[model samples]
Target: MSTTFPLLTATAVLPALGAVATAAVPAARREAAKWLALLVSLGTLVLAAVVLIRFDPGGARYQLTESHAWIADFGVRYELGADGIGVAMIALTALLVPFVIAAGWNDADADIEDSDAAKQRRWRPTQGFFALILMVEAMVLISFAATDVFLFYIFFEAMLIPMYFLIGGFGDRAHSGGEEDGAKQRSYAAVKFLLYNLAGGLVMLAAVIGLYVVTADQLGEGTFSLQQITEARAAGELTMGTNIERLLFLGFFLAFAIKAPLWPLHTWLPNAMGESTAPVAVLITAVVDKVGTFAMLRFCLGLFPEASAWATPVVITLALVSIIYGALLAVGQRDIKRLIAYASISHFGFIVLGVFAMTSQGQTGATLYMVFHGLSTAVLMLVAGFLISRRGSRLIADYGGVQKVAPVLAGTFLVGGLATLSLPGLAPFISEFLVLVGTFSRYPVAGIVATAGIVLAALYVLLLYQRTMTGPVEKPEIAGMPDLRARELAVVAPLIALLILLGVFPKPLTEIVNPAVEHTLSDVQKTDPEPEVEAAK
Candidate 1:
């Protein structure tokens, strides 16, 4: 039976409405804004959960689709739907926002003892912060759910706005040398992020127009529907010269790669994460970045299979470079935030590598990596935020004997760091293992070379821990640091629980993810390579 509903549309829009409601309250009742945002986010989570519960994982196509033509001439439509990948991303986005709200409850407000000048200039109104977060959530959900290529582009670009303000307006300016200088740095990071993504968006826009033109020329009309374009290509009704298809593929791939913040193009990520508040960092790294990999699987490969295959060697090479380069950079970082940022770059390399490897297990591992990385990174960044909030510094040398002062906090940090390194029996390990296994199935040399990154991962993580969390208390300022507060525990406990839970029983998530991976591989018309057996001697 075919079921039709506007559930996907509702899930995407509710957060925006919540943002509006949060902003409507008077400034006098500003604290209420956090509660309101949380309420809205929780409601949004419920809606996303409903979509997941109702989703037919057994089905091979998008579900709960709602489409209506908005521009008949251009063939654009306001369409929304989700396959398994989309659903998982949406659910992760929904799950993270409420916790981000909890974790960053007072993050926008200036410290109580700050100089009047600093306070006056740097204080962000709390209502606006939460509102921006909710707005970003809405856009992310829409981007993941959007079936029309143009609509996806709109949401994709629109998301940059809230994220920009979140980074620029609410960043940790006090930690920088001076208030003015810190604000300037934040503004610079924001602009750089915007320009990089905007340049990519413009390239993608050109490719989108070219695709539309080709479709129009072939069928006597233009269309921006992904399903139609894919179907047309499958039926041999849409054809472009080999060079042109590859060019278009590169255009879209560049945007996604930049957003993936793949190596060489990844310079902006450390700056952004270094300056932004914890929750904003979480949003940028954990939730928003997934859009890049998701789009690669959904659009790049689905729409341009041969181009993707042709580009695989180059893409996998970049992914490998990202893994090794990001790990080495992380090992040398002085700032804690930048180290985590670099670690994320390394982790994203794993995700991208699994993606381009084009094996079912690799693809599944990549998808699972997306979810697990989000959970783990959120914990690491949030815990680092908690430490920074107490120590008033982001440098690695600023603290020592932290475990003695705050054992719970130290333990939490260790667990997060271990998870990042893909510790055995943790959520990330299973996915990372799968990604490498799948990669080895097709390209043994790349997989074997990439394994060295795990050693680098341990080096960076353990070094960070040993330097900051161990040793005698060298500074009097560190001795009295508080353990995790009730609220802090509340914020981090679920993430920790999920990490452990998923590590033990990843079957539920993989069950939902595998079918989607199989479907994507079918679209690309590729399968895992057969293994060679040694002859009996």
Candidate 2:
């Protein structure tokens, strides 16, 4: 998979350059800027396709690698590479950005200057909104492809800047709180998101520095290169004391867990998604937040195998809590957006459970879950956003019998809900099933408790659909509500198609995912457990 050309760099840089060009567009030419950003994202998607095509799953582990000296004195390098897992995530990110852009076409109406809230917001420049999105995309793409731990950490934390502005400045216009209260809430959510992630980043910084020192002592040079460090450890040239390994592992894991937004570290997500516009919310969950879990596979496990194993039991416990607790909370949620947000927490719990399950099926399922969750969450959240925009209330009580008027919207939302609950004949079902199967093979009690989450998921998703989409059109605002418009349809349709297509024939994704899972298991020096029962042979 080695290459002389820098495809990875070009793939990342295109949107970054696009972001700059987009920001420089005439202040009044918002449409032009939007078009520019969309085209840039599409171009990025083309490059991602090439990356995927060039990738040989059966070839070397890391493909399309580009390495160059960056900070030789400190042993840092401008290294970028993609394994099957990284490439799959990169493809997911690329595939989704255009849809996010298309869905948020009018999310930040810079011309709505008549209202005091708009003026109070200083007619927040439309150019900045789109620019920030592209900027975030560039950072995330780099994060996925980055092989140097320092390089990854740099872009990992940098993505938050644009995301913070996207959430705080261009929040959802359909707030039940009135404009002023909504603005306050947006600011609060944005700040809380920043503080939470930044706290985790700071701890990670300490761990990063500790890693450099450890490498310096062991290898005679301070290095943050994942490949170099791993090779050294594999060669018996470097080893960490048990306590040191655990501390370093905690630093990395805490940051990822927060990014994963696992329970206890998950409070910021509800507020952030509740206050932000839906597209940005999707970016948070579907794209930006993935860096955390991806890092767990790449850095936490790849670099700290012993520590990863040592902490698996506790991590699995937290994941189980996240699964049940998030589903239970989703069942009780009155706000439509918060319900989706809480549901994501539960989905992430399943994902983390797979990661720590330490079985080949478990890790592979976790990886697939990330991609499927991105597609399904986008469909549900964007459609929900459309529904809320029509009613101007995020409250579930404000909606009723939507299917009667906007059947298309309701139908798409139902599919999304079913996917979220991992219903059979959907993409998420396979991933979730693999996770449970993997976990059961190792820890039956954990797997049994996790099934409770599936039941809870059914309750929340069905109840949400029942209350909002399939009722008597009692609420006056819903009677005149229209179905998914052409633009919104364009966004949700393909994602739904992907869900069904992958559901029935997951070979394409599984083919890519399985090899990556094998590499990851090798990193941890683990294998799938043997089945307890034998076929009647």
Candidate 3:
């Protein structure tokens, strides 16, 4: 199952190289830079698809692995591999980048050089914007494929740099409080995000050290290979002290929870998502943040089984709280983008809840949630972005009777909203159903409370639709809002198609994910509970 061809490395490195090339384009050729970025992302997608195709569901747990000496002294190696979970994430990341580039095509063009001050900036602002995005894609791909703990952490923390600049430098120009105040807000959000994650990464660094120390003592050499540690534990060759393991788990989990922004630690999300441009917002929720949840399944459960079980009760409680809190806050939001931000927090709750639920169905649902939520969120947010760009406002109160003026836009928006609420025929419904079924089997009380989130989701999504799309055109600004153009439609239509295609036939993803879910549950030494009632044969 391991390969010498280094396909995973190629998949990750291509975008990085493209990022440099795109950024190097002359300041005036914004169009050329965009095309270069798009081409590079498309190439990455092809490589990711190849990896998915070459993978065998019934093959080795980690396939297409490449290992070379990295740091002999510390036992770190340049290692990469993919399981079903990793491949799915890689596919999602690669698939979304092209659309992100297209959707944000003109986002950086405004104010590119209105002042002598603006003209002095080194690289073209437009090129830098797209380059930053591609750079993030490269880092995320490596995070997904990385088999070395140190390697994962390195890229994990590094991604924050580009994100910080993206939020602060290229923020939306529509300033509610004037341009000066808008600049301040972006600065605040960017700082808050960086400080929170950096704090968590520091804590995680301590835990990473703790984990390495444990492995070193047990194996007679320090190592950061996830595969090596996991195999050793499976073979009864490596054992961690309870106290040490719990501390390590807490450290790692804290970092991911902050990144996941699991409530209490989640305050930074609304600002970050609200302040960034729409494509970056999608990049934040749909792409970058999934790393937190994915890391939980890969590292937390993989490295510390007993500690994970010990922590499950509290984790699931936090998830339930996030679901309700995010949904409630979303219901009260007046801003279009912020509403989606709150809703994403709610969706991340479902994904996290499914992960901690531990049953095979739960894990599979969680992984699928990650994928479908990305698709649903992309469709919703990108369409919302287009709407905002036309009107130059993010406030919901500013819109009315959009359906009459721009029927196609309203229609697509409606579909996106329906998917967010997990309507039965939508892809999210499948993941949501599985999570509830899996949680109910193991913990009925938690399952019952979680359903309240569904009710609230319906409320927010419907109210959003009713207030914005269905009313009479009450403002002069609403009269000439054109419907979706070719570029915007190109960005959205594929995602909607995917939502329908996967909603009806999730067999493709399920077949790929189910086996990986089994492996994850095995790591945690858990199994699904038997049903109390069964259908008659």
Candidate 4:
């Protein structure tokens, strides 16, 4: 790539530029914005791919770091860099965006003019879609690349704005008359998603400020960058005591947990899924939510290694709860989208399970799991959106025998759903296996219980497939449902290829991840040694 401008920075900024250009088009010409957004997303994907190709898997530190002063007096800098984990997430974000655009294609103009009243209803969703997507892209990029703690928190919180608008404003619906109906549901979902995130973020803000204070007081006014924090923590300048570190860790953990929507905090996701468009849901559920798992690794583990060790049992218990809980709830869902949302919650439990396991293989699996899950979720959401659009309903009963008509569509959904269940030779199977293997070495009981979640995953995914794709050819509406078109296949097929390819040939991908993961574990080991236990004398 170019020497002067880093590829990672370009990948982040290009989408914002495209969003602006798309918004400037006249109302009548706004359709151009959709294509522009698609192109920008495609470009960002290419850039991320280039980063993967050029990245040195054996490197000891962040590659292609670009740092400059942003707020000089406050010691904040416009810093960006990625290790293996960041690179993988960057690619996942890029991969999700194009499919998001494709999934929303029909919904982008859902209220278009067939009559004068309908014409008035066309309030230009393309612009809002473009803007929200670009905003998400930029925020995710920043979150991935940021080497500074303060900058990381900023990007982490900024993501909420675009996501709130995407769920609340763009795809929202109002009830015909009752309070529990249509648009009212969307409003409630949006508010719950926002309020939960904002409250968590505010708590994190306090922790971030406190981190800076401690770093300054002890380390002699060094920058609030993550790299600096690590250096100080290493040099014995920053004391990671049980009380203070646990508080700080919780501050970071609560925000990420809410974002990950782990267990109880995950209540907002099903509601949000019910109201949002498929593409927006794909981005929110697939890419943006990865931020939570990503941050758990980046901030919680990175900054408070001692606390992480101290809190492992509690986190692991919660993860187990989410695994069993999300799966049981998913099995009970009538709304297909909400079912997928709960599946994500279950998958996230596995991701956290890996991280708290605190082994190299487990963390690597968790990180890779994020990438694999991102792809599968995107595929499911896009294809599910198509299915819903044709049937004019989100209920699974509306989809009985759809396979008899839309064979290609049903086939695509089958592939995605199977991957979600971690069928052998698919991507998730490997990641989930690695996580269980790695966690088994450390937290044996947790690993054993979490393995049961895989069985639950199978039940939910297979039941979804049976309800929507198999069974009797009873419903006439299912017979009329169209099969996948070329354009639709174009959007989903790459994801399928990647999923299979990664599952079979994970060596190349794992090599890219090993170096960064090794560095992370090295830090954790350095900060927290096993405490000396009193003998039973």
lDDT of 1 by residue, 154-230 (tens): 99999999889888888985474878888898999999999999999999999999988888999788998988888
Return the lDDT, model 2, position 52.
95
User: In every candidate, how many clashes are there?
Assistant: 0, 0, 0, 4
What overall lDDT, based on C-alpha atoms, would model 4 receive against the true structure? 0.83
lDDT of each: 0.91, 0.92, 0.94, 0.83
Candidate 4 residue-wise lDDT, 257-362, digit = tens:
9999798799999989878888788888888888889989888888998898888899999999999999999999888998999999999999999888888878
**Higher-TM-score candidate among 3 and 4?**
3
Report each candidate's C-alpha RMSD, comma-separated, in the order given. 2.3, 1.9, 1.3, 3.9
C-alpha positional error of residue 326 in candidate 4 after TM-score superposition, expressed in Å: 0.5
lDDT of candidate 2 over 1-537, digit per residue (tens): 778889999999999999999988875577898899999999999999999999988988888999999988988899999998999999999999999999989887733565556555533467788899999999999999999999999998999899899989898877777888888999999999999999999999999999999999988889999998888988999999999999999999999999989999999999999999899999999998888889999999998999999999999999999999999999999999999999999999999999999998888899999999999999999999888888889999888899999999999999999999999999999999999999999989999999999999999999999999986998778898988889999999999999999999999888887898898898889988877788897
Q: Which residue pairs of candidate 3 clash? A: none
Worst 10 residues of 1 by lDDT: 115-124
My TM-score estimates for the predictions, one after another, are 0.97, 0.98, 0.98, 0.94
Candidate rank order under lDDT: 3, 2, 1, 4
lDDT of 3 by residue, 1-537 (tens): 987788999999999999999999988678999999999999999999999999999988999999999889998899998989988999999999999999999999985766867666675889999999999999999999998999999999999999999999998877678889999999999999999999999999999998889998999998999989999999999998889889999999999999987987999999999999999999999999999999999999999999999999999999999999999999999999999999999999999999999898888999999999999999999999999998888999989899999999999999999999999999999999999988988988999999999999999999998888997998888898999999999999999999999999999888888888898999989989987899899
- Error in Å for residue 251 of model 4: 0.5
Give the range where candidate 2 is weakest over 10 consecutive residues by summed lDDT: 115-124
